[model samples]
Target: MESELKIVTFNIGKDKFGLDIMKVDAVIEYEEATTLPNTSDYFEGIINYRNEEVLPIINLRKKFRMPDFDDKTLAKVIVLKMDERKVGIMVDDVKNVRSINQDLIDEKPKIGGIRQADFISGIARLEDGMLIVLDIDKLITKEEKIAIDEVVTD
Candidate 1:
């Protein structure tokens, strides 16, 4: 039987990216994050969700080394659960959820010398264009995870 992979699509710069729907917890409107000091450039800081939980938000554009948005009014945050940790990834905009057949997904491409390529899990060949599938867990390094832990604990 052919299985389908459901993904939440979002725009970062001119490219479209996808996250496995299973990892996604919520798609919320972008809210200003409280900037933290002494963190990586991509670490946008933490936000309190409904006064119940605090999530560290990472600016995907900066993390991918893409150009920054002149205005961030249209930005959206994708809340994801990686294991027991919940983090938010900020994107230009949220696209839509799509279910693509597993057969349509190609192996992660061999992009030479691109650091960002390491985080790509695969590429889904949709009728419109290719969607970069991201391995959310691999997106953050061990050190970054420790930093995020510290951010959440402090």
Candidate 2:
């Protein structure tokens, strides 16, 4: 049987990327993240979404071994769901949504230095250019998730 996929397109650094929109609920503005204590460097912490507390997000900067954040770089959050629990994924910005068939995806080139090259599911060449398709479900794990302790609230 043939299957179709819906992808959410976005940018990180200078690169264009996409993940299945099934992995996303909505994209929202970047706000101050409630910082967490003694956690993985990737974890930026948590935020409040419509009364429900959810993880704020991790920046690609920290993920790619760049220095800690400064105030200049603008950002946004990609909201996701874990069962009924809500979470946010921080990205440079949200782009748009697009559809691609399962057969249309091309293989990602084998590369070193960036472990994430392996994390890419496939490269989808669109009318304009290429998009790095990601395996969002494998982006992290439950065991890998660390709780945030927001000072003002907690």
Candidate 3:
């Protein structure tokens, strides 16, 4: 139900954020990611998970124009499947898994610094701070997905 949202909190820079776990399929540690040239900066590369070659996995840092992925700061790829297709998202750090009732989730605030605020499902007011819930499906699209047919692993 939209009212009851199962969220996975993760660090995307200094701010706290949450993603509906329902949209998540799996979380894998950053490894030797295949690189796709001429793709969006956010599109780090493709990952072979469970025998399937998924398209580009977006790095939250790059997606928000933060920083380049480095070996020092390891990240988890939050796998998401939509319309029978799977994709992934990389976060600086995986924080916690929690639940929020519908009332706790509010419309996104007018204040903005990131990209399209509409991609945010809502702001979940947790006990500690506001968790930016992401609209996974809205964050990506068929046209936006970077092709990885020729991606080479390092």
- Candidates' TM-scores? 0.95, 0.79, 0.84
For model 3, name the residue pairs that clash: none
- Which one is best on TM-score? 1
The per-model lDDT (C-alpha) reads 0.88, 0.71, 0.74
lDDT of 2 by residue, 15-121 (tens): 78889888787788877777778667887766777675655576766775666546524787888755545567778878888888777788877677666555588
Ranking by TM-score: 1, 3, 2
* Superior candidate under lDDT, 1 versus 3: 1
Model 3 residue runs over 4 Å out of place are: 70-73, 112-115, 146-154
Runs in model 2 lying further than 4 Å from the true structure: 1-3, 66-73, 113-118, 146-154
**For candidate 3, what is the TM-score?**
0.84
Better of 1 and 2 by lDDT: 1
Model 2 poorest 10 in a row by lDDT? 145-154
Which lDDT tens digits does candidate 1 get at residues 12-83? 888999989999989998888899899999998898987889899999889888887677668899999887
Model 2's lDDT to the true fold? 0.71
lDDT of 1 at 12: 88
What are the per-residue Cα lDDT tens digits for candidate 3 across 1-154? 4568678888877888888887888777876677766877777777677776554577778766677656524777788876656777888788878878989999887785655656787888878988888888777754674343234322
